[model samples]
Structure formats: C-alpha cells, structure tokens
Target: MTLSYRVLIALLTPLIFIYLWVRGARAPEYRKRWSERLALQTVPVQARDGIVIHCVSVGETVAARGLIEDILRSYPQLPVTLTAMTPTAAELAQKLFADRVYHYYLPIDTRGAMARFIEKFAPRCVLILETELWPNLLAEAKRHGAQVMLVNARLSAKSLRSYQRFSWLLGPIWSALDLVICQHVDSERRFQQLGVARERTVVRGNLKFDCQVPAATTRAAKQWRTELARPILVAASTHQGEDAIILDAFARLIQAVPELLLIIVPRHPERFREVTSAAQQRFSTLTRSSGQTVSASDQVLIGDTMGELLFWYAAADIAFVGGSLIPRGGHNPLEPIATKTPIISGRHVFNFQPLFDRLTDVNGVRLVDDAEQLAEQCLQLLQQPVQGQTMAAVASEEFAAEHGATARVLADIQGLFPPPNGQARTLKMILTSNPNAATEIWFDDNLATAVSDDYFAPSFWRQKGQIIGSATGRASAWFIQHQPQNMLLRHYYRGGLVGKFNRDRFAREAIVKSRAMAEFSLLLQLRELGLPVPQPIAARYQRAPIWGYRADILVAVIADSQDVFKLLLQRSLTAAEWQSVGATIRQLHQAGVYHSDLNCHNIMLDQAGKVWLVDFDKCGFRTEGEWQQANLQRLLRSLLKEQGKAEQSQQLFHWQQTTDWPHLLQGYEQA
Candidate 1:
C-alpha cells in the first residue's frame, strides 16, 4: 500500500508544482521558499537533534502556540524546528516566535524530500498538530528512529469514514504514531477504529481552550475599545460565501442599531482585498492596513492585518465566528471565549461540532440559520448588553474549565524523551571511570569527547585559555568559553562556618549519593519536567582517601540572561515581567520542585524576558505542603534584604512591595 501511494505521489509530482504555480498567481508567497519545500536548505548546528513541529495552516499554528511555548520552557536545551504548509501559517510562526524557534516550510511528502529533511535536522521527535498526516513523512521519521506523535488530534465521523475507505493506505501510517493525544473521546475511538493501538491513544482536551490573551493584546484591545466607544461586532475568519451573508446581516443590523460597527476578517490572506471590496459596496468601510483612523460614521472595518484576530475579538462587544454561514465548517470560537466575548455562529460547524455542541449546551453560543437570524441575533445581543455579558461569562467559565491540556500534552511529549542515562534511543549519557584514583565522570554522550577528571580542574581550562571569567560566592565558579557553547564549572563547598574548615570535602558516600551525582540527576529530572534550568554537561567526584570526596560540575550557561538580582539593580521590571516571574515560580512549585534556596539571585531574566530558575544544587522534589508558601516568602525576604542593602549604600533597587508583589501573586494564582 505504501509503495503504491508513493508511486502515485511520484507520478503527480509535476501536477503539484503546477498547482503551486496556480496558487502563486493568487498568493505569490506560495512560489517563495522552494528550497525549503524541497528540503534543500542546510540545517543550522543548533537545530540538530531537536524537535520538529508541523502546523499545517494559520489555525493550527495559532492553536499550537501554547503547546509550543510550554515545550520550549520545559526543554530549554533543545531546539525546536517549526514547519507549516501555508504562507500565512509560516509568517504567523515567524511573527510569534521570532528567533526563538527555527521556521521552515514542510518538505513535500516524497521519499527523497522526507529523507533529506529527517537527516538534516536529525530531530529526536516529530509532533504533528491537528490532522496533517503525510505517509512518507511519518515513515521516514520512524525509519530514522524519531518518535512521532499527533497532538490536539480530532477526527470527525465524516473524516473517519473517509480514512476508513482507504484503510489499506492509511492503516500503516496510523500505526506509525508513537501516540495520539486526542481532543475528544470520540476522536480517540475513531482513531482506534482505524489502526492505532488502544494503549497509544489518550484524550486530552482541546488546546484552543488553553489559549491566553497576551497582556499586550489586552492593552491594545482596551485602547481600541476606548477609541471606538460604540457597539462593535467582529466577524472573524470569514470564508468566500460567508462574507456576502455577513454583509447582508450587517445591512439589516444597522437599521436597528445605526451606531453598530462590523469588522470582518477573512480566513485567507488572498481574500482580504476581495472581502474589503465587498464590504465597501454596502457600507462606509476602512481597512486596518490602510492606517486610517476609523470615524464615527464608518459602519464597516476590514481586519486585513495578520496576528491581530485575538485583539479584535477582545475589543468586540459581540463576535460572530465566521465560515459557518456557508458550508466551510467554522473557525475556532474559543478565541472569543478566551477574551470573554459573546459568540454567535451559523448551523454548519461540523469541523468543531463537538465543541460547538458543548457550548450550545451551556448557552455559551447563539446558533443562527441564515442571514436573517444572524442579524436578529446580532441586534438582540447589541440591544441587551447584560444578555451578551451573561453568555460571555458562561463561555469564559467553560473555557477556563478546559485548561491544563497544554500541561497534559507536555507530560506526554516529555514521556517521549527518556532520561539521558536511560535506555532511550534519542539521548544518551556516558560514564567514564578511572580505577587507579577511585574517580568517575558522567557526561552527555553528545559532547565532543568523553570527559575525565582533568576537565573539572580549573587549571585545565586556564591552560587552554578558555577561562573567561569568575563569580564570587561561598566558592568561586569559573566560566569557560567553549566552542559552540559556554560552560560554567562550580566546585561543591560547605556553607557558613563549616566551609572555613572543610570547604570542598565531604563524608564518604555512595557514588549516586554524592553531591555532584545527586545534583546531576536532579537537573535531568527537572529538564524532563519541562522546567527551565541550566543543562548539566559533566559531573565528577575525586576521592581524597580518608577525608572524603571532592565534587565539581559543569553546566551550560543560559545565553543572554542575568540574575534577577542584577536586573533589578539596573532597572525596574514591568508589571508583566513581575507576573511572569511569579508564574514561573508557580510552575516549579506545581512540578513539586523544592528549591533549597528560592531567592532573587536564583531567578533569571533572559534577553527575551523569559523567566528561568537556576542554581538547584540542594533542590529536590517534595510532596505538596507549606514549603511552597515558605519558598515564596524566602524569595520575598531576599528582595527586601537586597533593597535594604542598596538603600544603605545609596544604590538603586527597583522593587515596590505593594504593586509588584500583588501583580506577582496575581500571576501565580492565575498560572
């Protein structure tokens, strides 16, 4: 079956290019990036041995944003390569992640292209968002020993029957999946009916429900609302046939409420001009890209801009989720739900029928049958603000209840990446021994070479002219300028008065119980939990006869970051940044991590303003208890103590107890 399918794709290769050329006539971006489409581009060194996520179009890309961010936070050490089929989705991925992730066009699903892609990236895992299943792509990844999983997977009965009709071709492809994280139980059953093993499928809720309105987006929406004080109706992701119906509905809605404004956003970028032209034929229209301020007399606005759909939804008093007025199914209604906006949709929502059904059950969305009903619903919602608010409240509650899918999906993805020392084919750790000195070294196998005790010696780096700098604490930590990456080497030392007598010595213990080994293992566990922490490079223990053993560990430096203590000394953190810090701490606590010392010094803010927790020397997992609160209090005391010292020295410290602490707490509780 696979052979026949490949033969068919090979035969249609020319037609595929012709199709692309045809699409390029309407949207020129389709003709761009042919090298990426053919898997002809060179993979960067940093992107190798990482994870590849496939989001077919803009909707899938938007839905997968939360999941991708969680993946990045959990495995800060691993690079992520994002691939999309459409130009809009490609552009959206770039705008969303910027330089944080590698973006590329997914290679056409051919044997040669798939092989080159898999070999170049050498990805350890491939995650397919939603339902983009290509036979050769899955087979090549599996052939190269990369785990493949389908996330936010949904298969309606219609799609299931369609796949079942060609079971011979798709059965093996379905079986190739390491796991299928479904959005509904019905989807799980459909996948099982096809070919997936029961053990390999689990039903996690929809990721769209986990979508968050960014703080910046909320602020922008607030400004927009203040600018346009009149009632606003946002028609989002409209399709070709649906725009006419929506325009007709707006025509009728204006008779009842002349001050109401309609903002229509087309689903595809190529249709933006067409939709804008159509809306202008009926009412005074303004396109968002025109940079023209909207007047009170303007009744129509075209949201032609990309990546501002959420902002429009937030600014709207009522949202009409488009594509349903015609037979094109519908876009995600959860976007408006996340923004606490009332929703109205047409009857045809089979693409997300289960979700729509659930929302309808709770009176969260009003379903319309035609233009007449759509206008009626819009007028009713506009006239009765309290009714609209009540509906929005119910939808928001349901949306909030569906949270945690991102966490669940992260857990499943983490399961695919086993411990470095485990028998996982993806990552491996090497243990080198020196029987002569009762010494041992544990290091990542991906390192250039197997490290020895000499690698731990400061003199080893100093002799090679690799020592870049040093930091003062109870013991000094030396920074090494290693090729392709930087490293920090720290020797374990006893703190306080005990450090004066025996700075680096410890009682004899088993190798696994030693400080270096324990910390190394804990770091690995933390990475698996998806917490942002320094990557452990190598750890060693050198025996000192009867006295005990001395330990040292080398970890990769987090690039472009400073400890919060250092950042606060220079400038005050924005309210959002403070909240992010609190949210990050909450994530650690939720993961059962008990940082022996949770202080401002241990918290880091990267150049991108991502919060990171470091220095887990004595930290370990603990059961849920009062220690979480105590841990937070410790961080607060550290902030206060630093502020006091700075005041005495007449130095600047930018922390406010009332405002910043409350914002932090808000972020913590929300997270």
Candidate 2:
C-alpha cells in the first residue's frame, strides 16, 4: 500500500464513520452493526474455504444477486460469504440469500481491517461487483493466495481520469487480479488502459442486463392492469427536481387527454412524503402506501412503496424513466422493458448510454427534454397505439438480445477451475522491455533470435523469399522458408477507425498488452491445447521516442496447405471436408478459444484433408455462448462476400449447401 493512501485513509477514517452515523439517522440499519464494518466483532476460530463476494451498495447488490444465486445453484458444494459496504446492501443480501449465503458488512480498507476480513473469510476466490477499487482489500486477499476477480466491471470517462491520476499507486492492485469480467468492449479498453492484461480481461456483458424480474413482480403487475386510468404514465425513479418537470408535463398531457394518470416514483424513500405534498397541489392524488386503491378519478399516484417500480410500470400504458430529465445519471430502463411498456426517456442517460442508444436508435425509447417535450412525446405514444406497440416490441427484443451474457460469464467461472486431466501448461518465457518507453518483447524460452529486434520487419521478409504478395488484397504477411521451420511473419497493421491515421502504429503499451506479443502467447496456449495452429517462434516490437510502436510475430507455417476460401474456388468441399472444418473449429472452442475474426480463409486444409486455423490476430479465449453462432455467421458472411462476385464462385459455395452446410452444423452440434 502507498504511504500517502494509508495516511489519507487514517485522516479520513473518522469522517467516514461520521458519514455512516449520519446515514444511520435516516435508516438505523447502518448503526446496528458498526463493529462488523470495522472488522472488530468477528470471532470465528476457523475460516470457510469457499467464495466471498463484495457488493458496494443497493445497485451492486441487485446486480450481484443473480450471480450469487447462480453460484449457489451451480456449485453448492462450496460455501459462500457475501459482504456489502452499505447497510441497505447488507439487508437486501440477507433477505435475498438468508440461509444460502453468509452476509456481513464489509470492513474499511485499513490494512489491519482488510487483513482481518481476509483471514476470517479465507475465501478461495474474491469476486467484487462493479469497479470497486478497494486497494487494501484486494491486495490482502491476493497475498493470501485467493483468486481475485472483478465481475460486471465498467469505468466511466470521469472514473477513468480519476483512476489514472493514482495509477502509479493502483497499478499493482489491478495486476493482482486473476480475472476481470468486463461489461463490454469499452470497459475492456479502459481496464487495459489501467494496466490490465488482455488475457485476464474478458467482455462478459453487464449482469444488470442478465436480471429477471421476479415472477411475483410479473404476477402482481397483471392485477394492476385494471385499476389505473387509460394512457397512465409512470415517471419511475424521479430525483429531486425531475418530479416537478414530469408533473408539469403530466399536467399538460392531462389537457390533451382528460383522463390521463401520472404515477411518479421518487428515487429516495425519504423524499416520498415531500414530493407527494408538493404534487397534490395541482392534481387529484393518492399515495401508493396509503392502502387506498387508485381509480380513474385520481389524476396522480405517488409511488411511496419501496421496490415495486416494476408493478408501477406494468400498471401504466406509458413509462417515462426519470433520472434522465436532470443531471442525475439515469435509472435502469430494464424494469419497464421487462413488461414491454412503452418508454419515454429524458435526453440525459449517460449511466446506461449504450442501452439507451440501442433503444432510441430503433425508436424503442422516445427521448424528450423539459416539460413540454416530455408532454408532447408522451402524448404521441399515447395517441398512436401501433407506434407504441412497435417501440415496445423492439425494446423487448433488444433486451432479449442482451441475455446470453449470463451463460458466457458462467462459462468463465467454470474456466477458473483447473482442467480435469491436468492439461494446464506451466508456461515460462523471456521478457524484456524498453527503459525509455513502454514497449516489451516476449519469446518462448526455447526460442531466441540472432537478428536484431527488426527480424520480423518487412525489409527482412522482403530480402528473404515471400509466398504471399500485395496482390492478394492483403499486403500484411510473407511466408518464409527456413532450415528448421517454415514461418509466416506478419507485420501488425491497424484495422478499423484508428488504421486510417497510421496503419502500423500502436500506442506503446505494456509487456502483456502488446498486440503481437499477446497473440504469440495465445498461439502457444492454443498449440498446447492440441488445436491445429502454427507454432510461435519469436515476437518483438520497437517503441518510438514519445508514443506509438510497430510490432510483429513469427509463427511456423503449415506446409502444402490451402485455405478453405482458396480450396472452395478450385473445387467443392466434400461433406467429409465440411464436417472436418466444423470439428476443427469446435476443438478450439471446447478449449475456450474465441476467434474474433473467424473466416473461411482462416481455416486451412492439407493433402490429407486435415484442417488448421491460422491468422489468430486480435483473438483470445472467451466464455462460449451465442458467440459461437456469431462466429459461424461471420464465416458465412466472409464466404458470401468472397464468392458473391461471380456465379462460378457462387456455384462452388452454393453446391455445399446440400451436403457441406448440413454436416458442418451436425459436426458442431455433436462436438
């Protein structure tokens, strides 16, 4: 731990306690177990060797509930301890898993407290929800040989900047993690920027999206359908100032349609009474907690109950999710989406921007600004039932589309355990980095280079013989014939948006993050898994004075082989050949390989019809799920793109539909 951090924690520890005490004034649960929060009340003589999961607050508690339940259901043999930073989280966790999980208040991050907590749990693994960067807690757990994982992780730009300021202090804490399950590609990028290795980070999607509304919630929603007025609007999770604007909008909407009902759910329970008093001045209102049934005569409903936001959405014809109206980062839309209720969102939704983007792009969500715009938008959805239904269908479809991430994450959890047959490799390598810059080169211990670091450079390959040339529409590689082995040397070239600026430039990165170096390491792992792939001989890179670098990797080539793309144009692939292709890819998938750019050209066939996958650049292992279908779809698209130019090419590909496609899918299914 950094001395400055320790000193800061020491200075602020009293204020932290004060803050907890103040919170306890509103909700006494925070005061009930003060000792547990300090790690002073634990008296267990023996530690439980299972898993410990930490959730920071209510949002995190909700997100992790599914994952904890999954762990209990799937791996009931191992004990579990759940810890929360806030009393609300602790109470919710206990309620969710009262007998199933051991629930406790997480201790502060002092070294002694963290060490004591670690010792008490003696957890086999520590899985923390979201981006909680408790340095002492993580470091202590890791020191005790616990596998530390950051699950459903993400970082906003603001958070990233804040973390970068103290990166020197926190880099080691991040490096201590054995695995990091990121929410998306962007989160993976941010984590990588923060000194995380590509191998350890996996984009497993956000678990919040994986949540299912309780069957009780769905069943209760149905009963609410008959009570509310037509075109009823729910402004769920409304913050301080947002209620007035939504109420104003509802007032205007009421003018357009005389019988409209608006149910406003304030975000905090403490504000429920205050908001209800203010709202009653302009409309006929009733509080949800009053044990009074709402009717068409009631122009407004104050949702004062805790955690029935779903039922309110289900009761309404239209739902306007509130935190979006003001500066408060938006609440989740999944609750409304769960019931296929039409949604109206205010312009701001940075918290779940990607989710909102997917919704609004398809008109699944109607974005509005202040009172008038919200009134107009809500009126539009209310009047046009077809439009509402279409938006609702697409919104539900979009939500359904994000579902498979849970299974993929579970696969990653299973991957944490060692192989049944002890097939894991004890990989050791030689690594050297530039002192002047953040660049590194890695090579297998058995391999070494006599040439300079530029051995894999283009000039070196051009001076030697070349099998692949520029005319192939890819001037990226050259096949070299050597005494001991034939190797394919590929110069790293950028793809996508960044490539336009500099095709061969990469921001000088750490040892494990270098594209060429990471790929080389992965190929070694793939080869050991007995997959048909090239052997990596050497990899190296050169960093510039300031930033950006070029790199390359040399892998032993498969001789006397032709890519499936090339083979297809020459002749139709036999059914056996197609089956072999499916079986070959499945072998890698079973070993947890995620070929990011799986294409017909990547798969090769030799004289004996043996198949091998090559060009494993920008690829790594991922928890397998819908991605398998996506991979197949990408290969199919690649084949069509490659062959669509001519009927002769088409006939060769189309011929396989009857024989090749069927057997290929069958082989995959069998595997």
Judging by lDDT against the true structure, name the best candidate: 1
Q: State residue 408's C-alpha deviation in candidate 2, in Å.
A: 1.0
Indicate the worst ten consecutive residues by lDDT in candidate 2. 418-427
Off by over 4 Å in 1: 418-671
Tell me the tens digit of each residue's lDDT in model 2 across 266-365.
8766577778988889889899889988776888889876556667887778988888988887878877887789998988898888789999787799
User: What is the C-alpha local distance difference test score of each model?
Assistant: 0.86, 0.76
Candidate RMSDs in Å, in order, are 19.8, 23.2
Clashes of each: 1, 0
For model 2, what is the alpha-carbon lDDT of residue 507? 82
Cand. 2 Cα-lDDT:
0.76
Q: Candidate 1, residues 282-349: lDDT per residue as tens digits?
A: 78999999999999989999988788899999999999998898888887888899899999999889
Whole-model lDDT, model 1 = 0.86
Local error of candidate 1 at 364, Å?
2.4
Q: After superposition, how far is residue 532 of candidate 2 from its true place, in Å?
A: 40
